[model samples]
Target: MTKELLTGNTAVALGARLSGVEYVPAYPITPQTEIIERLSRWANEGAMDARVVTMESEHSMLTAAGAASVAGVRTFTATSSQGLLYGFEMLYNIAGWRAPLVLANVSRGVASPITLEPDHNDVLSARDSGFLQIHAETCQEALDSVIMAYRIAEDDKVRLPAMVNLDGFYLSYTREPVDVPEQERVAEFLPPYRPQSGYMSAKNPMSVAVVVLDGRAYSYFKYQMHLASTNALAVHEKVAGEFEKAFGRKYPAVEGYMLEDADYAIVITNSLTTTARAAVQEMRKEGKKAGLVRIRLVRPFPRQQVADMLAGKKGVAVFDQNISVGSGGILYPEILSALYHRSDRPKKVVSFIGGLGGKRVGHTEFRHMVAVTEGCVRDDSQLASVLLFTDSDWQAVKGMLRTAGKGEVSQ
Candidate 1:
């Protein structure tokens, strides 16, 4: 077992190499550029026996990747927020064709007013785009999930594209100790590329990715994508078990910390879970039974597992870095959906939106979220979604409410 400090981008490159990918077509984008850069260097140095294609834009990148995958090569690529949207059509094409390629998306906040920061909007925007999504909390998972993605995507039962996501500045730029498994061991785990249908051979001359389906046929094809994504929930657990047996570490789709006897918990994803962990520890130190649940896989969602872990808790504070426009937060409703039918559901779930556009989320802010959760539990009449701001405007609004209530009562 060899351990080295590697940034999340390098870890992904290493994982792709280990997965025996034979082709990479990508364009340079901030936060995600380093992933392609390292892969290109590895291919050039013959460390990886893969062909690296530099594309003019994200659209061309996916186009080439899809074509290469159809040509019977294990293909890989990386992109960011706007790049993902730019290549959005090709994402559906890749999945519709049942091409089993693995793509890494370094999660960046989407733009109107542009800023490079970690947010789920970039990835969430592709939720229904027929790709299996895996969100990584640490550098290790970022690497490990890439290997698992290939296995899940290429499985004969579930041949579909997969996206392994890491936060932009948080995991992408941050360096951490990662255990890179030996090449021979990885080879045993991930075999060479064997395309489902041998492409470009004299034995088969057929049109690849041609649109010739009727409306009902198209709906059936799309339903197949849903089946593949749903299959990932079990496949993830199976692969994680195998990975732990090989690497001495176990990764759950969604991991819960200190919730065995806790009264309340916080549910979050990616690097923010680290901040939540610290806050949970401090809250526990003060005799509050606070805990955390970190979501490692977002696409398959692990809905049953999440519901089982969080059921019967006093309350849950959901922190999301992405907003759903009219909805409070993307994850807030998902959590509620999971717990809605439970007999012992959490009394209240307070949704707190923060860290949009890559703003830093400190432990103090996480602690404040916990305090808000505590207040919600104490007083059941509070609003479901609370937008935390740096100023006291909310307090002023509360005072005005009190004044109006008193006047109405006197009348």
Candidate 2:
């Protein structure tokens, strides 16, 4: 293995290359196009043994990817926010078809109000679409998760598609040191893709499209998909173990930092978790019993692990990067639900939404969250979702409103 400075996009490409991907069906989009560009260059130069096909649209790109995977070959593909939305329909198809392929999603904030920054909305939109999710907090995790995703997804007990997500501009473009494992070592960790039994091939030709005439039949298949997804939890733990033994890096479903004896906890995910980590350290130095829990494996949502981490805390704040519109932060209630049944559940649970459209989430916002959670716990009162909007953010918005000839709006 050799250490090299690499961007998250380049790391993903190297991971795919080292994993021996046989095909890549691609559609170019900001942040994500760099990954495909590198792969295409390598494939063209004969440096990587793979077929890189440029599809006309994200829809067709995913369709071709699923088709190739079902046809018994290792496949990969990537997309960003709008591009991922464009191909949303194929997400369910690929997962329902039980295609064991890998997709790298560079998370970008969605449209309606447009920006080229990072958020979890695009990927979270596919949460119930039957795809397993692995969120990365750094360029290194971005590379390692893609490699681990293949092993988890292709497991016989969990034959489902998996997505490896990283924040678009944050990790995607930022350069960092990465350990690129030797191909021989990687092969020992992840062998060639052996198509599952009944996969489409010349020697085992079979119909992949199955039609159900009754609701009962449909329910059975859907339940099987759920079971398969749940199976990924164990499969991920097993693969993560082997990965650690082989590479000396261990990734768990949920990672806790200084959480063992904390009085307060912050729950977050994706690249923003790095900033939260530093905030936790500062809080520790200030004599606050603060900690952080990062959700790494999002789907097959690691419920038991999360509950165990946040158990017995005095106050718990869930920081969500995406909002659910009328509801609130997407991850808030999910974490709440996870802890609801535990006897040692947190005394106070609060929600904070920030980092939308890749806006910077500094120590100020984290400190604010901690303060608010402390207040909520002291008063034993319920608090609605708090938006992490600062005075500067409001002033900028006011400027935009005035420029648009709109009357002043109250803060």
Candidate 3:
């Protein structure tokens, strides 16, 4: 193993290469382009033995990837924001086929008002799309997750596609020290792709992903998919254990920091969890009894682990980087549902939305979240979701409105 400073994109490319991937179907998009670019370069230089194909669109790219994986080849692909949405339709088709491919999604804010920054909306949008999700907070985790994703996806009990997500620009552009494992060791950990089912070959010709015309057949197949996805919970644990023995680092589904004896807990995900960890340390110095929980594995929700972590806290704050349009933050209600039936649930739980469009969420935002959570605990009252905006933020927007000749807008 060699430790070197590498960007998250490079790390992901290396991980894919180390997994002995045979095929990569790609289309260029901001942030995500670097990952495919690195892979293409390695393939061109003959450093990696793989077929790298540049497709016309994200849709075509995913279709090609699915076809390769179903043909008993180890396949990989990547995309971001609009690109992810563009190929959204094929996500279900691939999962239903039990293709067992890996997709690296560099999370970016979706377009409407348009921005090229990081956010969870694009990834969270696929929560119910039959793909298991593993989010990363650092360059090293980004690399490790990609490698582990392939193992989890290809397991016989959970033959489903997996999405490894990292925040765009944050981890994508930022450089960090990553321990790159030797190929010999990685090979010892991950074997080549020899699928046990849904493989199309001359020796074994089989028809797969067929349409079920009847409602009963459709329901049965759909429920089977859900069960397969649920089986990932155990599969992930097994892979994570093996990965740790092979690489000396293990990632849990729901990871807690200083949460054992805390009265207040902060729940977060993705790259922002790094900042929250530091904030938790500062809060600890001030004797605030604060703690943090970072949700690494997002699909199959990990509700049991989450509920177990926040069980007896005085108050809890769930921070979501994505909003659910007419509703509030996408993760808040889900977190609440996880804790609702617990015998020793938190005294109060609140939701805070921030970090949209790659907005910076730092110590100030962390303090505000803790304060709101404290208030909830003190008053024993339910509160609506709060958007993490400051006075300066509003003033800057006002300046833009004024420049556009709109006057006397409500604060």
Tens-digit per-residue lDDT, 1-411, candidate 2: 899999999999999999999999999999899999999999999999999999999999999999899999999999999999999999999998899999999999999788889989999999999999999999999999999999999999998999999999899999999999999999988988887777786787777567778689889888999999999999999999999999999999999999988899999999889889999999999999899999999999999999999989999999999999999999999999999999999999999999999888998789889989999999999799999887899999999998999979778
Give each model a TM-score. Answer: 0.92, 0.97, 0.97
Per-residue C-alpha lDDT of model 3 across residues 30-93, encoded as one tens digit per residue: 9999999999999999999999999999999999998789889999999999999999999989
Per lDDT, what order, best first?
2, 3, 1
As a whole number from 0 to 100, the lDDT of residue 391 in candidate 1 is 53
Worst 10-residue lDDT window, candidate 1: 402-411
Query: Can you rank all candidates by TM-score, best first?
Result: 2, 3, 1
Locate the minimum summed-lDDT window of 10 residues in model 3: 205-214
lDDT, candidate 3, equals 0.92
lDDT of 1 by residue, 156-220 (tens): 77788899999998999999999999989888777777788556544677776567556887777
Local distance difference test scores for all models: 0.86, 0.93, 0.92
Clashes found in each candidate (C-alpha, N, C closer than 3 A): 0, 0, 0
